[model samples]
Target: MADIQRLSLNQATVQNWSVKEAVDGCVRHGIPSIALWRHKIHEAGLQQSAQHVRDAGLHVSSVCRGGMFVAPSAAERKERIMDNFRAVEEAKELNADSLVMVVGASTEVPIADARQMVADGLAELVPYAREQGVKIGLEPLHPMYAGDRSVLNTIDQSLAMAAPYAADEVGLILDVFHIWWDPTVFEQIQRAAGRIFGFHACDWLVPLPDTLLGRGVMGDGVIDNHALRLAVDAAGYNGPIEVEIFNQALWDTPGDDVLNKVVERFTALV
Candidate 1:
Protein backbone atom coordinates (compact mmCIF):
# COMPACT_ATOMS: atom_id res chain seq x y z
CA MET A 1 0.00 0.00 0.00
CA ALA A 2 1.11 3.52 -0.64
CA ASP A 3 2.02 5.64 2.37
CA ILE A 4 -1.29 7.35 3.18
CA GLN A 5 0.47 9.78 5.46
CA ARG A 6 2.33 11.32 2.55
CA LEU A 7 -0.70 11.94 0.31
CA SER A 8 -1.80 15.46 -0.51
CA LEU A 9 -4.95 16.44 -2.41
CA ASN A 10 -4.16 19.32 -4.69
CA GLN A 11 -7.36 21.42 -4.72
CA ALA A 12 -7.44 21.38 -8.53
CA THR A 13 -8.18 17.67 -8.35
CA VAL A 14 -11.49 18.56 -6.77
CA GLN A 15 -12.22 21.62 -8.86
CA ASN A 16 -15.72 22.02 -7.54
CA TRP A 17 -14.86 22.20 -3.85
CA SER A 18 -14.64 25.45 -1.98
CA VAL A 19 -11.66 25.98 0.28
CA LYS A 20 -13.68 25.06 3.37
CA GLU A 21 -15.15 22.07 1.58
CA ALA A 22 -11.75 20.87 0.39
CA VAL A 23 -10.33 21.13 3.87
CA ASP A 24 -13.31 19.30 5.34
CA GLY A 25 -13.11 16.61 2.67
CA CYS A 26 -9.46 15.98 3.44
CA VAL A 27 -10.21 15.84 7.16
CA ARG A 28 -13.14 13.48 6.68
CA HIS A 29 -11.09 11.29 4.33
CA GLY A 30 -8.02 11.19 6.61
CA ILE A 31 -5.87 12.96 4.06
CA PRO A 32 -2.98 14.68 5.85
CA SER A 33 -2.10 17.34 3.32
CA ILE A 34 -3.58 19.69 0.65
CA ALA A 35 -2.36 22.00 -2.11
CA LEU A 36 -4.36 25.20 -2.40
CA TRP A 37 -5.00 27.23 -5.54
CA ARG A 38 -4.83 31.02 -5.49
CA HIS A 39 -8.24 31.66 -6.98
CA LYS A 40 -9.87 29.43 -4.39
CA ILE A 41 -7.87 31.13 -1.68
CA HIS A 42 -9.12 34.47 -2.95
CA GLU A 43 -12.68 33.18 -3.07
CA ALA A 44 -12.54 32.09 0.58
CA GLY A 45 -10.34 34.94 1.73
CA LEU A 46 -6.73 34.04 2.49
CA GLN A 47 -6.89 34.56 6.26
CA GLN A 48 -9.98 32.39 6.63
CA SER A 49 -8.55 29.72 4.34
CA ALA A 50 -5.35 29.64 6.36
CA GLN A 51 -7.34 29.44 9.56
CA HIS A 52 -9.48 26.57 8.26
CA VAL A 53 -6.48 24.46 7.25
CA ARG A 54 -4.65 25.30 10.47
CA ASP A 55 -7.67 24.38 12.59
CA ALA A 56 -7.96 21.10 10.74
CA GLY A 57 -4.24 20.45 11.28
CA LEU A 58 -3.66 19.75 7.60
CA HIS A 59 -0.30 20.34 5.96
CA VAL A 60 -0.24 22.88 3.11
CA SER A 61 1.95 21.07 0.66
CA SER A 62 2.04 23.97 -1.76
CA VAL A 63 0.26 27.05 -3.04
CA CYS A 64 -0.54 26.81 -6.80
CA ARG A 65 0.84 28.94 -8.34
CA GLY A 66 3.10 31.94 -8.84
CA GLY A 67 4.85 32.29 -12.16
CA MET A 68 3.83 33.75 -15.54
CA PHE A 69 7.14 35.31 -16.46
CA VAL A 70 6.89 35.51 -20.24
CA ALA A 71 5.45 38.73 -21.54
CA PRO A 72 5.85 41.09 -24.52
CA SER A 73 7.34 44.01 -22.68
CA ALA A 74 9.83 44.63 -19.90
CA ALA A 75 7.23 46.53 -17.86
CA GLU A 76 4.82 43.62 -18.16
CA ARG A 77 7.49 41.21 -17.00
CA LYS A 78 8.13 43.45 -13.99
CA GLU A 79 4.43 43.36 -13.22
CA ARG A 80 4.51 39.59 -13.37
CA ILE A 81 7.39 39.55 -10.89
CA MET A 82 5.43 41.87 -8.61
CA ASP A 83 2.52 39.44 -8.72
CA ASN A 84 4.87 36.63 -7.71
CA PHE A 85 5.90 38.65 -4.68
CA ARG A 86 2.25 38.56 -3.65
CA ALA A 87 2.09 34.83 -4.27
CA VAL A 88 5.06 34.36 -1.95
CA GLU A 89 3.20 36.35 0.67
CA GLU A 90 0.17 34.09 0.31
CA ALA A 91 2.32 30.97 0.65
CA LYS A 92 3.92 32.41 3.75
CA GLU A 93 0.51 33.13 5.24
CA LEU A 94 -0.58 29.54 4.65
CA ASN A 95 2.75 28.17 5.90
CA ALA A 96 2.86 26.13 2.73
CA ASP A 97 5.84 23.94 1.81
CA SER A 98 6.39 25.93 -1.40
CA LEU A 99 4.79 28.27 -3.92
CA VAL A 100 4.42 26.19 -7.09
CA MET A 101 5.32 27.92 -10.36
CA VAL A 102 3.82 27.25 -13.78
CA VAL A 103 6.19 29.48 -15.65
CA GLY A 104 4.49 31.10 -18.62
CA ALA A 105 5.16 30.68 -22.36
CA SER A 106 4.56 33.19 -25.14
CA THR A 107 4.62 33.61 -28.91
CA GLU A 108 5.28 37.30 -28.54
CA VAL A 109 8.96 36.66 -28.00
CA PRO A 110 11.46 34.10 -29.29
CA ILE A 111 11.55 30.90 -27.25
CA ALA A 112 15.09 31.64 -26.19
CA ASP A 113 14.06 35.08 -25.01
CA ALA A 114 11.10 33.66 -23.17
CA ARG A 115 13.39 31.25 -21.33
CA GLN A 116 15.64 34.16 -20.39
CA MET A 117 12.61 36.04 -19.07
CA VAL A 118 11.79 33.10 -16.86
CA ALA A 119 15.31 33.10 -15.48
CA ASP A 120 15.22 36.84 -14.89
CA GLY A 121 11.85 36.60 -13.23
CA LEU A 122 13.17 33.90 -10.94
CA ALA A 123 16.19 35.96 -10.04
CA GLU A 124 13.91 38.77 -8.93
CA LEU A 125 11.38 36.61 -7.06
CA VAL A 126 13.60 34.06 -5.31
CA PRO A 127 15.05 36.65 -2.94
CA TYR A 128 11.57 37.77 -1.95
CA ALA A 129 10.46 34.17 -1.46
CA ARG A 130 13.53 33.55 0.66
CA GLU A 131 12.87 36.65 2.71
CA GLN A 132 9.27 35.58 3.33
CA GLY A 133 10.31 32.08 4.40
CA VAL A 134 8.72 30.44 1.37
CA LYS A 135 10.17 28.03 -1.16
CA ILE A 136 9.57 28.35 -4.91
CA GLY A 137 8.60 25.06 -6.61
CA LEU A 138 9.34 25.30 -10.35
CA GLU A 139 7.11 22.90 -12.30
CA PRO A 140 7.89 21.96 -15.90
CA LEU A 141 4.83 21.33 -18.02
CA HIS A 142 4.74 18.78 -20.87
CA PRO A 143 6.22 19.99 -24.13
CA MET A 144 2.75 20.07 -25.65
CA TYR A 145 2.15 23.11 -23.48
CA ALA A 146 5.34 24.83 -24.51
CA GLY A 147 3.58 27.27 -26.83
CA ASP A 148 1.24 28.68 -24.23
CA ARG A 149 1.47 27.11 -20.81
CA SER A 150 5.18 26.96 -20.08
CA VAL A 151 8.51 27.23 -21.83
CA LEU A 152 10.13 25.07 -19.18
CA ASN A 153 9.16 21.55 -20.24
CA THR A 154 11.88 19.19 -19.08
CA ILE A 155 13.52 18.19 -15.79
CA ASP A 156 16.90 19.15 -17.24
CA GLN A 157 15.65 22.64 -18.06
CA SER A 158 14.00 23.13 -14.67
CA LEU A 159 17.05 21.80 -12.84
CA ALA A 160 19.29 24.21 -14.68
CA MET A 161 16.96 27.09 -13.88
CA ALA A 162 17.02 26.14 -10.20
CA ALA A 163 20.77 25.48 -10.09
CA PRO A 164 21.77 29.00 -9.06
CA TYR A 165 19.59 29.06 -5.96
CA ALA A 166 19.78 27.25 -2.65
CA ALA A 167 17.72 24.06 -2.53
CA ASP A 168 15.39 25.59 0.01
CA GLU A 169 14.91 28.82 -1.92
CA VAL A 170 14.14 27.26 -5.30
CA GLY A 171 13.44 23.65 -6.26
CA LEU A 172 11.66 21.42 -8.77
CA ILE A 173 8.08 20.11 -8.54
CA LEU A 174 7.95 16.86 -10.52
CA ASP A 175 4.56 15.78 -11.87
CA VAL A 176 4.24 12.34 -13.41
CA PHE A 177 1.65 13.50 -15.93
CA HIS A 178 4.18 16.01 -17.23
CA ILE A 179 7.52 14.23 -17.07
CA TRP A 180 6.72 10.53 -17.55
CA TRP A 181 7.51 10.57 -21.27
CA ASP A 182 11.00 12.01 -21.00
CA PRO A 183 13.77 9.58 -21.91
CA THR A 184 16.12 11.02 -19.28
CA VAL A 185 13.55 11.61 -16.53
CA PHE A 186 14.86 9.01 -14.09
CA GLU A 187 18.40 10.24 -14.61
CA GLN A 188 17.27 13.82 -13.99
CA ILE A 189 15.28 12.74 -10.95
CA GLN A 190 18.45 11.31 -9.46
CA ARG A 191 20.32 14.47 -10.39
CA ALA A 192 17.58 16.44 -8.63
CA ALA A 193 18.19 14.52 -5.39
CA GLY A 194 18.51 17.31 -2.90
CA ARG A 195 16.31 19.82 -4.75
CA ILE A 196 13.12 17.92 -5.46
CA PHE A 197 10.71 19.87 -3.29
CA GLY A 198 7.40 18.47 -4.53
CA PHE A 199 6.15 15.37 -6.35
CA HIS A 200 2.71 15.34 -8.04
CA ALA A 201 0.85 12.19 -9.17
CA CYS A 202 -1.64 11.70 -12.02
CA ASP A 203 -1.71 9.84 -15.31
CA TRP A 204 -1.84 10.92 -18.95
CA LEU A 205 -4.95 9.81 -20.78
CA VAL A 206 -4.14 7.69 -23.88
CA PRO A 207 -6.33 9.71 -26.25
CA LEU A 208 -6.14 13.08 -24.63
CA PRO A 209 -9.50 14.71 -24.09
CA ASP A 210 -8.12 18.21 -23.87
CA THR A 211 -4.55 19.36 -23.90
CA LEU A 212 -4.92 21.48 -20.82
CA LEU A 213 -7.41 19.35 -18.86
CA GLY A 214 -6.62 15.79 -19.91
CA ARG A 215 -5.01 14.37 -16.77
CA GLY A 216 -6.38 11.07 -15.45
CA VAL A 217 -6.46 9.68 -11.94
CA MET A 218 -3.58 7.49 -10.78
CA GLY A 219 -4.50 4.26 -12.53
CA ASP A 220 -6.89 5.52 -15.20
CA GLY A 221 -4.17 6.14 -17.76
CA VAL A 222 -0.73 5.05 -19.05
CA ILE A 223 1.77 6.43 -16.54
CA ASP A 224 3.93 4.20 -14.37
CA ASN A 225 3.09 6.15 -11.22
CA HIS A 226 4.59 3.64 -8.80
CA ALA A 227 7.98 3.65 -10.48
CA LEU A 228 7.99 7.43 -10.71
CA ARG A 229 6.98 7.68 -7.09
CA LEU A 230 9.83 5.39 -6.12
CA ALA A 231 12.28 7.43 -8.13
CA VAL A 232 11.12 10.64 -6.47
CA ASP A 233 11.38 9.06 -3.05
CA ALA A 234 14.84 7.80 -3.86
CA ALA A 235 15.81 11.36 -4.77
CA GLY A 236 15.71 12.34 -1.09
CA TYR A 237 12.27 13.96 -1.20
CA ASN A 238 10.05 12.57 1.52
CA GLY A 239 7.42 15.27 1.12
CA PRO A 240 3.73 15.01 0.22
CA ILE A 241 2.81 13.29 -3.06
CA GLU A 242 0.02 15.45 -4.41
CA VAL A 243 -2.88 14.22 -6.59
CA GLU A 244 -3.36 17.01 -9.17
CA ILE A 245 -5.60 15.76 -11.96
CA PHE A 246 -7.18 18.33 -14.27
CA ASN A 247 -9.74 16.32 -16.28
CA GLN A 248 -13.05 18.02 -16.93
CA ALA A 249 -14.89 14.75 -16.35
CA LEU A 250 -13.37 14.45 -12.90
CA TRP A 251 -14.19 18.08 -12.28
CA ASP A 252 -17.85 17.41 -13.06
CA THR A 253 -17.94 14.45 -10.70
CA PRO A 254 -18.92 15.08 -7.09
CA GLY A 255 -16.01 16.10 -4.91
CA ASP A 256 -16.55 13.26 -2.44
CA ASP A 257 -16.55 10.71 -5.22
CA VAL A 258 -13.36 12.16 -6.69
CA LEU A 259 -11.62 12.00 -3.34
CA ASN A 260 -12.79 8.44 -2.84
CA LYS A 261 -11.34 7.31 -6.16
CA VAL A 262 -8.19 9.29 -5.55
CA VAL A 263 -7.51 7.52 -2.28
CA GLU A 264 -8.35 4.13 -3.77
CA ARG A 265 -6.21 4.54 -6.87
CA PHE A 266 -3.39 6.23 -4.99
CA THR A 267 -3.04 3.31 -2.57
CA ALA A 268 -3.40 0.65 -5.23
CA LEU A 269 -1.51 2.28 -8.07
CA VAL A 270 0.73 5.14 -6.98
Candidate 2:
Protein backbone atom coordinates (compact mmCIF):
# COMPACT_ATOMS: atom_id res chain seq x y z
CA MET A 1 0.00 0.00 0.00
CA ALA A 2 1.13 3.58 -0.65
CA ASP A 3 2.04 5.26 2.62
CA ILE A 4 -0.53 8.03 2.94
CA GLN A 5 1.36 8.98 6.10
CA ARG A 6 4.09 10.25 3.79
CA LEU A 7 1.92 13.08 2.49
CA SER A 8 3.23 16.53 3.52
CA LEU A 9 1.70 19.99 3.67
CA ASN A 10 3.86 22.48 1.84
CA GLN A 11 3.20 26.05 3.13
CA ALA A 12 2.69 27.65 -0.28
CA THR A 13 -0.56 25.70 -0.57
CA VAL A 14 -2.20 27.91 2.03
CA GLN A 15 -0.97 31.40 1.20
CA ASN A 16 -3.77 32.68 3.36
CA TRP A 17 -3.28 30.36 6.32
CA SER A 18 -1.17 31.53 9.24
CA VAL A 19 1.63 29.27 10.51
CA LYS A 20 -0.35 28.18 13.51
CA GLU A 21 -3.44 27.61 11.42
CA ALA A 22 -1.60 25.52 8.84
CA VAL A 23 0.12 23.37 11.42
CA ASP A 24 -3.13 22.97 13.29
CA GLY A 25 -4.84 21.94 10.08
CA CYS A 26 -2.18 19.29 9.51
CA VAL A 27 -2.71 18.05 13.02
CA ARG A 28 -6.43 17.90 12.43
CA HIS A 29 -6.09 16.02 9.16
CA GLY A 30 -3.23 13.81 10.37
CA ILE A 31 -0.99 14.98 7.54
CA PRO A 32 2.27 13.62 8.93
CA SER A 33 4.70 16.24 7.64
CA ILE A 34 5.35 19.62 5.94
CA ALA A 35 7.77 21.78 4.02
CA LEU A 36 8.14 25.40 5.18
CA TRP A 37 9.22 28.64 3.52
CA ARG A 38 11.39 31.39 5.04
CA HIS A 39 8.89 34.23 4.48
CA LYS A 40 6.21 32.37 6.38
CA ILE A 41 8.60 31.80 9.24
CA HIS A 42 9.35 35.52 9.36
CA GLU A 43 5.64 36.38 9.49
CA ALA A 44 4.97 34.13 12.46
CA GLY A 45 8.36 34.62 14.11
CA LEU A 46 10.75 31.67 13.65
CA GLN A 47 10.61 30.45 17.21
CA GLN A 48 6.84 30.56 17.22
CA SER A 49 6.59 28.94 13.82
CA ALA A 50 9.00 26.11 14.64
CA GLN A 51 7.24 25.51 17.93
CA HIS A 52 3.86 25.45 16.26
CA VAL A 53 4.98 22.75 13.83
CA ARG A 54 6.71 20.81 16.58
CA ASP A 55 3.74 21.12 18.90
CA ALA A 56 1.42 19.77 16.24
CA GLY A 57 3.66 16.68 16.14
CA LEU A 58 4.42 17.20 12.49
CA HIS A 59 7.73 16.35 10.85
CA VAL A 60 9.32 19.18 8.88
CA SER A 61 10.50 17.39 5.75
CA SER A 62 12.40 20.44 4.64
CA VAL A 63 12.76 24.22 4.79
CA CYS A 64 11.72 25.40 1.27
CA ARG A 65 14.90 27.04 0.17
CA GLY A 66 18.19 28.73 0.30
CA GLY A 67 20.34 29.18 -2.80
CA MET A 68 20.03 31.80 -5.50
CA PHE A 69 23.74 31.06 -5.96
CA VAL A 70 24.12 33.08 -9.14
CA ALA A 71 24.73 36.83 -8.99
CA PRO A 72 26.48 39.48 -11.09
CA SER A 73 29.13 40.52 -8.62
CA ALA A 74 31.31 38.81 -6.04
CA ALA A 75 29.56 40.88 -3.38
CA GLU A 76 26.17 39.70 -4.55
CA ARG A 77 27.26 36.06 -4.58
CA LYS A 78 28.74 36.38 -1.11
CA GLU A 79 25.50 37.95 0.06
CA ARG A 80 23.58 34.92 -1.19
CA ILE A 81 26.04 32.64 0.59
CA MET A 82 25.60 34.55 3.86
CA ASP A 83 21.86 34.33 3.46
CA ASN A 84 22.13 30.53 3.15
CA PHE A 85 24.04 30.52 6.44
CA ARG A 86 20.97 31.98 8.09
CA ALA A 87 18.79 29.38 6.36
CA VAL A 88 21.08 26.70 7.75
CA GLU A 89 20.61 28.10 11.25
CA GLU A 90 16.84 28.02 10.78
CA ALA A 91 16.96 24.43 9.57
CA LYS A 92 19.03 23.39 12.59
CA GLU A 93 16.52 24.97 14.97
CA LEU A 94 13.61 23.04 13.48
CA ASN A 95 15.59 19.81 12.93
CA ALA A 96 14.20 19.65 9.43
CA ASP A 97 15.43 16.91 7.09
CA SER A 98 16.96 19.19 4.48
CA LEU A 99 17.22 22.73 3.15
CA VAL A 100 15.72 22.94 -0.36
CA MET A 101 17.92 24.74 -2.90
CA VAL A 102 16.62 26.47 -6.01
CA VAL A 103 19.90 27.08 -7.88
CA GLY A 104 19.04 30.46 -9.36
CA ALA A 105 18.06 32.09 -12.62
CA SER A 106 20.15 33.10 -15.61
CA THR A 107 21.79 36.50 -15.40
CA GLU A 108 23.26 38.92 -17.96
CA VAL A 109 26.33 36.68 -17.90
CA PRO A 110 24.85 33.47 -19.36
CA ILE A 111 22.89 30.43 -18.18
CA ALA A 112 26.01 28.31 -18.41
CA ASP A 113 27.96 30.82 -16.33
CA ALA A 114 25.14 31.00 -13.81
CA ARG A 115 25.27 27.22 -13.61
CA GLN A 116 29.00 27.35 -12.83
CA MET A 117 28.28 29.82 -10.06
CA VAL A 118 25.72 27.39 -8.67
CA ALA A 119 28.39 24.70 -8.69
CA ASP A 120 30.88 26.99 -6.94
CA GLY A 121 28.35 27.96 -4.32
CA LEU A 122 27.44 24.36 -3.58
CA ALA A 123 31.09 23.40 -3.24
CA GLU A 124 31.36 25.82 -0.32
CA LEU A 125 27.83 25.51 1.08
CA VAL A 126 27.70 21.73 1.18
CA PRO A 127 30.47 21.46 3.77
CA TYR A 128 28.87 24.22 5.84
CA ALA A 129 25.50 22.45 5.58
CA ARG A 130 27.04 19.18 6.75
CA GLU A 131 28.74 20.89 9.67
CA GLN A 132 25.43 22.54 10.59
CA GLY A 133 23.66 19.17 10.31
CA VAL A 134 21.49 20.38 7.45
CA LYS A 135 21.32 18.59 4.12
CA ILE A 136 20.82 20.66 0.96
CA GLY A 137 18.29 19.38 -1.58
CA LEU A 138 19.07 20.82 -5.01
CA GLU A 139 15.85 21.03 -7.06
CA PRO A 140 15.90 21.42 -10.83
CA LEU A 141 13.26 23.84 -12.04
CA HIS A 142 11.33 23.24 -15.28
CA PRO A 143 12.92 24.32 -18.55
CA MET A 144 10.43 27.17 -19.04
CA TYR A 145 11.54 28.58 -15.68
CA ALA A 146 15.24 28.32 -16.58
CA GLY A 147 15.51 31.95 -17.64
CA ASP A 148 14.08 33.52 -14.50
CA ARG A 149 14.04 30.75 -11.94
CA SER A 150 16.74 28.06 -12.24
CA VAL A 151 19.40 27.13 -14.73
CA LEU A 152 19.49 23.54 -13.52
CA ASN A 153 16.37 22.36 -15.39
CA THR A 154 16.54 18.59 -15.46
CA ILE A 155 16.98 15.76 -12.92
CA ASP A 156 19.93 14.25 -14.80
CA GLN A 157 21.61 17.65 -14.95
CA SER A 158 20.87 18.30 -11.29
CA LEU A 159 22.38 14.97 -10.25
CA ALA A 160 25.44 15.57 -12.39
CA MET A 161 26.04 18.81 -10.48
CA ALA A 162 25.12 17.27 -7.14
CA ALA A 163 27.47 14.33 -7.61
CA PRO A 164 30.43 16.26 -6.24
CA TYR A 165 28.57 17.11 -3.03
CA ALA A 166 28.21 14.76 -0.06
CA ALA A 167 26.12 11.80 -1.07
CA ASP A 168 24.55 11.19 2.35
CA GLU A 169 24.30 14.78 3.54
CA VAL A 170 23.88 16.75 0.30
CA GLY A 171 21.27 15.65 -2.29
CA LEU A 172 18.42 16.52 -4.67
CA ILE A 173 14.80 17.56 -4.10
CA LEU A 174 12.62 15.78 -6.67
CA ASP A 175 9.38 17.61 -7.34
CA VAL A 176 7.35 15.75 -9.96
CA PHE A 177 5.45 18.84 -11.10
CA HIS A 178 8.58 20.45 -12.48
CA ILE A 179 10.29 17.48 -14.11
CA TRP A 180 7.40 15.25 -15.23
CA TRP A 181 7.25 16.93 -18.61
CA ASP A 182 10.86 16.01 -19.26
CA PRO A 183 11.61 13.24 -21.75
CA THR A 184 13.95 11.42 -19.34
CA VAL A 185 12.10 11.36 -16.05
CA PHE A 186 12.57 7.69 -15.23
CA GLU A 187 16.14 7.58 -16.43
CA GLN A 188 16.99 10.51 -14.17
CA ILE A 189 15.17 8.87 -11.29
CA GLN A 190 17.31 5.77 -11.77
CA ARG A 191 20.43 7.91 -11.98
CA ALA A 192 19.48 9.91 -8.88
CA ALA A 193 18.97 6.67 -6.97
CA GLY A 194 20.27 7.14 -3.40
CA ARG A 195 20.87 10.86 -3.74
CA ILE A 196 17.13 11.65 -3.92
CA PHE A 197 15.93 13.49 -0.83
CA GLY A 198 12.41 14.91 -0.57
CA PHE A 199 9.88 13.82 -3.21
CA HIS A 200 7.57 16.84 -3.67
CA ALA A 201 4.39 16.62 -5.74
CA CYS A 202 1.75 18.77 -7.51
CA ASP A 203 -0.26 18.42 -10.71
CA TRP A 204 0.76 20.38 -13.82
CA LEU A 205 -1.78 21.84 -16.24
CA VAL A 206 -1.35 21.44 -20.01
CA PRO A 207 -1.75 25.12 -20.77
CA LEU A 208 0.33 26.39 -17.91
CA PRO A 209 -0.26 30.03 -17.11
CA ASP A 210 2.27 32.80 -17.75
CA THR A 211 4.92 31.42 -15.34
CA LEU A 212 2.97 32.95 -12.47
CA LEU A 213 0.23 30.53 -11.40
CA GLY A 214 -1.98 27.79 -12.86
CA ARG A 215 -1.83 24.39 -11.23
CA GLY A 216 -4.44 21.65 -11.57
CA VAL A 217 -5.54 19.50 -8.66
CA MET A 218 -3.75 16.13 -8.41
CA GLY A 219 -6.06 14.26 -10.78
CA ASP A 220 -7.14 17.30 -12.77
CA GLY A 221 -3.78 17.65 -14.50
CA VAL A 222 -2.23 15.42 -17.16
CA ILE A 223 0.61 14.12 -14.95
CA ASP A 224 0.37 10.51 -13.89
CA ASN A 225 0.79 10.94 -10.12
CA HIS A 226 0.93 7.22 -9.39
CA ALA A 227 3.77 6.71 -11.80
CA LEU A 228 5.55 9.73 -10.32
CA ARG A 229 5.22 8.37 -6.77
CA LEU A 230 6.19 4.90 -7.90
CA ALA A 231 9.43 6.21 -9.36
CA VAL A 232 10.34 8.01 -6.13
CA ASP A 233 9.50 5.01 -3.99
CA ALA A 234 11.39 2.75 -6.34
CA ALA A 235 14.40 5.01 -5.94
CA GLY A 236 14.27 4.08 -2.22
CA TYR A 237 13.07 7.45 -0.95
CA ASN A 238 10.59 6.44 1.72
CA GLY A 239 9.93 10.02 2.81
CA PRO A 240 7.09 12.52 2.76
CA ILE A 241 5.28 13.17 -0.52
CA GLU A 242 5.46 16.93 -0.01
CA VAL A 243 2.78 18.81 -1.96
CA GLU A 244 3.91 22.14 -3.49
CA ILE A 245 1.19 23.68 -5.63
CA PHE A 246 1.46 27.28 -6.85
CA ASN A 247 -2.08 28.00 -8.01
CA GLN A 248 -3.28 31.57 -7.56
CA ALA A 249 -6.98 30.69 -7.66
CA LEU A 250 -6.58 27.96 -5.10
CA TRP A 251 -4.65 30.26 -2.80
CA ASP A 252 -7.56 32.69 -2.79
CA THR A 253 -9.94 30.12 -1.32
CA PRO A 254 -10.24 29.09 2.32
CA GLY A 255 -7.45 26.75 3.49
CA ASP A 256 -9.90 24.25 4.89
CA ASP A 257 -11.56 23.85 1.52
CA VAL A 258 -8.18 23.73 -0.20
CA LEU A 259 -6.76 21.15 2.17
CA ASN A 260 -9.88 19.05 2.08
CA LYS A 261 -9.50 18.76 -1.66
CA VAL A 262 -5.73 18.19 -1.45
CA VAL A 263 -6.01 15.39 1.10
CA GLU A 264 -8.79 13.79 -0.89
CA ARG A 265 -6.97 14.10 -4.21
CA PHE A 266 -3.64 12.92 -2.82
CA THR A 267 -5.33 10.01 -1.06
CA ALA A 268 -7.23 8.88 -4.12
CA LEU A 269 -4.50 9.44 -6.70
CA VAL A 270 -1.04 10.73 -5.68
Query: RMSD to the native, candidate 2?
Result: 1.1
User: Model 1, residue 226: what's the lDDT?
Assistant: 96
> Which candidate ranks first by TM-score, i.e. highest?
1
Question: How many clashing residue pairs are found in candidate 1?
Answer: 0
- lDDT winner: 1
Backbone clashes under 3 angstroms, per model: 0, 0
Query: lDDT by residue for model 2 over 1-270, one digit each (tens)?
Result: 356698899988887888888898898887989888998888999899889987888899999889999888999899999999899989888889999999887557598899999999988788888898898999988888888889988888888898887688778898878889888798889889899988877888877764757877788789988898898888888988888888889998988898898898888887
Estimate the Cα RMSD of every predicted model relative to the unseen true structure.
Answer: 0.7, 1.1
What lDDT score belongs to each candidate, Candidate 1 first?
0.94, 0.86
Q: For model 1, what is the error of residue 240's alpha carbon versus the real structure, in angstroms, after optimal superposition?
A: 0.3
lDDT of 1 by residue, 118-176 (tens): 99999999988888899999999999989998999999899999999998789999999
